[model samples]
Target: MPVDPDKARALAFPPVTVTVERGRLRMFAQVIGETDPVYVDPAAARAAGHPDLPVPPTFFFSLEMESPDPWSYLADLGVDLRRVLHGEQEFSYHAMVYAGDTVELRPRIIDVYTRKGGALEFLVKRTDIRRDDRLVAEATAVIVVRDPEVAS
Candidate 1:
């Protein structure tokens, strides 16, 4: 069945949260090819004025992976996941992310629009990395989901 464009536009997804740990930070640094000592060694991070291991600027993307399955949210909008393609991704960071911080992710459907050939869904996800209500960092991500037919 063809998806209802209006319904898809109104879909809302639940929020996801993750606790940042030292091991995860080290793993993320390795995955991103970060050779900085601050990312891997606690002593180095402390020497650099950080309380613990520091994550790279792009490390916030890893936090999004812990969020609710984005595909499931699209399914609720009547969009088929098999036809979805990642069009673009952009991130705005307000501060650095470090280990031992608990981050809360609140995702919202920013916009849903269609062109002549396919649909585009824009989502703005806000992640608040906090330590006991103290704001550590704010990361805003914009994700664009494009329909396959639009490319052809």
Candidate 2:
């Protein structure tokens, strides 16, 4: 394995607080072709019984990307970016979120495993997002690392 499972499991990213912004959300809606007006217009969102433009799905991913020191998690695991592949991502929503709300994300290592005689390493992280102590979403990301020595 490129990374020791024990060592990787000890890695944890600092909690990050982000305030959802309308402009960014609108741009995201535009880019992803989310024709839903609720994603782009606050008025439409209010009409739909939302405080503000409901955060379009998957917006948390982008917010987390902007997290302080986005590479800190990898650094703690001593993983090389060149050998890492973003294998998968998933999100579980617990409650609705709106633009302008401040959310905090706490990310931790959830699983670490190896395959193919340790030539392939799989690392999974689960990030919990909360709004004022209420769980809003939990995002999972899977990273696959290829051992450089195995390639030779």
Q: How many residue pairs clash in each candidate at the backbone level?
A: 0, 0
Candidate 1 structure, TM-score to reference: 0.74
Candidate 1 structure quality by residue, lDDT tens digits, 36-105: 8988999999999998997677666677677657458766765566656665455665566678877766
lDDT of 2 by residue, 19-83 (tens): 99999999999998889888999998999899998886688888788786887777667778888
**Steric clash pairs (candidate 1):** none
User: Where does model 2 exceed 4 Å of error?
Assistant: none
Of the candidates shown, which would achieve the greatest TM-score relative to the real structure?
2
lDDT score at residue 13, model 2, on the 0-100 scale: 73
